[model samples]
Target: MNNDILDKITFDTGGLVPAIAQQHDTGEVLMMAWMNRDAVLETLEKGQVCYWSRSRGKLWRKGESSGHVQRLVNFRIDCDGDTLLLLVDQTGVACHTGRHNCFFQSVRDGEVEIISEVEISPDEMYGNKSGGK
Candidate 1:
């Protein structure tokens, strides 16, 4: 693939761009992550979603351990060239908290509330007890 496309993206000072992953068929917004130049190219080349982990400070291949992978269907760039939208085929829960998606919180009656339940336990997903978010 031609790498010239990446030059158009407006990466932040940290050389990162926010990427939003959405379900291709249902259009469900699954999760949000970050990506650097290499991560974007790797995802395009491999046909799987790869992200730059801000916390880990490394390239994080989706489903590297948990077996919940996100396959790329379509990749898009925002008009501002600072954000990305990835249309993906999500295999399982997208959130580390074992929820279906990341945006599981909502405000109802002026109070913050949890809107979703865990589909799988953290131990089941990652083989450890504390499945952090």
Candidate 2:
């Protein structure tokens, strides 16, 4: 199918939309990322998960810096055409904190708390600052 087929889909305010990655077999939601047109196009064309980095303001390939690539298996649009559900085969940790997923924490009692401990050191993925502050 051509990318044009998705021209009917509606994108939101930032010319970007929410994309959720779920495990193809187990149906576990792996992560959520923003996707602009180019990211969506590149994801489909490359079969690798590509996301728009909000903080750095650039296109970020999932495993480029962390070696935790998300392989695309399939994709679908929400009924309103504003959200995307991606079926993927994820490799390594999906969270920057090196957990299986970014949603390692759960909220309860109107407060947020950590449900999972760090699976790997942040320095392993993001490097560290030597200054003690």
Candidate 3:
């Protein structure tokens, strides 16, 4: 699979690099997550996005629970080699809050405003009330 490029990535001390998921066709950013070496390799091998869940301390297969899977289109590393960009075809809402993306908050005039509305209820996505990401 020519994964030699992985060697050039500089993961942090936690063995994780910030991965930003962006829509492949459009420029809309879906979400940001963390990826360890295994997560990165798994995503490449499986053609689906996988992330390291810092809160759960485990490999988080996106859409495993929400059915909002992200299919890998392209993977890229920043010039600094410390960050990664994943161009993906998103299946559904990316945010746990049921928003299309995570960056729903906007700050203007020193006031925080929500720029996006929830498309789906988190309860419906997670099948629970916690609405966790």
Candidate 4:
């Protein structure tokens, strides 16, 4: 929790770094999000995944409202110190679309295809709230 550790990260010109969250046991990537310095410290301090929301322009704690919380198991910084890797225990579905992960689409033969199925409905996850997807 030292300031120096956080300072070592090379944030982008926008003062943000890309953080990738992966399932701890399976090594399956769940999502990719941005994290500011404060977010990195907060996640380490709180033992929860926190991200910087570019659209909302604020700190977004994972599953704060969606009930798909990500519990931090381990944290790693890439060799260049420009990116972060979060090994976490994901509860429920990681994607707001009610999928296990955000990467559900794939580009094969130059055609976009859906590779995964929705485990639950977005309405069920977000309580009939539109724009959750």
TM-score, every prediction: 0.95, 0.87, 0.95, 0.94
- For model 4, what is the alpha-carbon lDDT of residue 14? 99
The alpha-carbon lDDT assigned to residue 1 of candidate 1 equals 76
TM-score of 4: 0.94
RMSD of 2: 3.8
Model 4 error, position 93 (Å): 0.9
Q: lDDT tens digits, residues 1-133, model 3?
A: 5667788799999899999999999989989999999999899999999999999899999999999999999999999999999999999999999999999999989999999999999989999856544
Each model's lDDT: 0.91, 0.81, 0.93, 0.91
User: What is the lDDT, from 0 to 100, of the residue 95 in candidate 2?
Assistant: 78
> Which residue pairs collide in model 2, if any?
none
Residue 44 in candidate 3, Cα distance off native in Å: 0.3
- The candidate maximizing lDDT is 3
By TM-score, how accurate is candidate 1? 0.95
Clashes of each: 0, 0, 0, 0
Q: How many backbone clashes does candidate 3 have?
A: 0
Which lDDT value does model 2 have at 69?
86
Candidate 1 segments whose C-alpha is farther than 4 A from its true place:
129-133
Candidate 1: pairs in clash: none
lDDT of 4 by residue, 1-133 (tens): 7888887799999999999999999999999999999899999999999999898899988987788889999999999999999999999998888899999999999999999999988888888885232
